[model samples]
Target: MNAIDQNAIQTLFTEARTHNVWLDRDVSEQTLRELYHLMHFGPTSMNCQPLRVLFLKSQEAKERLKPALLPGNQEKTMQAPVVAVLGYDTEFYEHLPRMFSHNKEAKSLFEGKPDFINATAFRNSSIQGGYFILAARALGLSAGPMSGFNNAAVDEAFFPDGKVKSNFLCNLGYGDASALFPRQDRFAFDEVCDVL
Candidate 1:
């Protein structure tokens, strides 16, 4: 397979920064729809696609979310053009029959198995969340993914039905580079990975 262009790599990873501050700009609904369209293509185990997003765009919506946020995350999350409440559908297996076309019995395999379900939901939602961040970057938006919040409180506020569980919060907007601190270090391949 051919490598992607350098500019694409830069946008998605090398030059991408986890932004905490944003420009006073708005993210249009069209751009957000496009982001989801791109991110949905990311692969998930058994095509489970557990990750769900609640985009808090209005001031009222952001207000509702504030009580769940950690003090450090409050201001930036409120200021962001969009704050996405990323979640995992607890009953994701219900969609498996439709998603896993090759195996109609896939739903049955996961049914009545809370342990398997929880693990799959958590693991795949994390993968999907990563894809969501990259997709936002690809579409010329910045993201600040954070977890310094009360999960249960967030779930109560945003996902009261209990069908979905909040996984993390991501602030999305056009970033202001002037506010960024110096970039941090990353582990080398030898330090973090093993070449098999």
Candidate 2:
């Protein structure tokens, strides 16, 4: 394949700041599906694909989420076109026979171990969340991911059965650039990376 254009890369990464302000436009359901279709291809450990997203679009659902937010995150969570409740299924391993080994044998790896199940769920689901952000960007949407909410409360409100648990929240929409603060600085490569 030919190299990706520099401008496209810049648009998806460098110039793509974390959006805090959003416009009044609505995000269509089809668009959301398209975003998921693109993101689902990103690999995870053993193809566990543990992420479970709850898209809050209606006013009632958004209101239900309010009590779970920290004081600082309330406004952003309420104003965005959609607030995705990113979560992980603690019982994800139950499906491993289909998702991982493609045979009945894979269930043995995590059959009775709660600790192993939790570890795999959190690790793979976090990776899935990363893919979600990238997929949103690829679909011309902006994101503001935050962890300020009460995860327990969110889980109670959204996933009452306890099979799934919240990880982080992301606001999604067409960003209101006029409300953006000046972009912040970042650490240089030497400050964050090392050569082998």
Candidate 3:
């Protein structure tokens, strides 16, 4: 497969920043749908595809989410065009029969296994969250993914059914780049990776 150009790479990674401040802009419903369509194609373990997103776009919806956020995250998240409550369904294995059609027995592996179910759901959903950010960026939006929130509170407020668990919160919108701090440092490849 051909590699994407440098500009595309920059859009997805290099030039992308974790934006805490949003401009006075709105993310349309169509863009939100398109974002999910692009990210859903990202691969998951055994095609589990357990990531379930709840996009909080309205003032009322964001208000329901307010109490769950940490003080530092509250203002920015409230101001964002969309605050995505990224979660994973504990009952994801039930859908394996439909999602992993090639392997009819895939569902059996996770059924009645609480620890296994939780591990797979969390791991795969986290991977999908990464894809969500890239997809948002590719569509010319900025992302601020944060974990400073009360998980149990959020789950009760939004996913009260208990079938899904909140993984993290990401604020999405047209970023106020001027509000960003100077780019932070990262470990070099040699410091973080080893060639075997």
Candidate achieving the largest lDDT: 3
Looking at model 1, report the run of 10 residues with the lowest lDDT sum. Answer: 95-104
| Candidate 2: C-alpha RMSD after superposition | 1.3
Q: What is candidate 3's local distance difference test score?
A: 0.96
Error of 3 at 22 (Å): 0.8
Local error of candidate 1 at 177, Å? 0.6
lDDT of each candidate versus the true structure: 0.95, 0.90, 0.96
Cα deviation in Å at residue 89, candidate 1? 0.3
lDDT of 1 by residue, 1-196 (tens): 9999999999999999999899999999999999999999999999999999999999999999999899999999999999999999989999987899899799998889999999999999999999999999999999999999999999999899999999999999999999998999999988989877
Candidate 3 stretches with Cα past 4 Å from truth are: none
Candidate 3 structure quality by residue, lDDT tens digits, 117-182? 999999999999999999999999999999999999999999999999999999999999999999
Q: Higher-TM-score candidate among 1 and 3?
A: 3
Candidate 2 vs candidate 3: which has greater TM-score? Answer: 3
Q: Please identify model 2 stretches exceeding 4 Å from their true place.
A: 102-104
Task: Sort all candidates by lDDT, best to worst.
Answer: 3, 1, 2
The candidate 3 region of ten consecutive residues with least summed lDDT is: 104-113
Q: lDDT: which is higher, 1 or 3? A: 3
Model 1: how far residue 29 lies from native, Å: 0.7
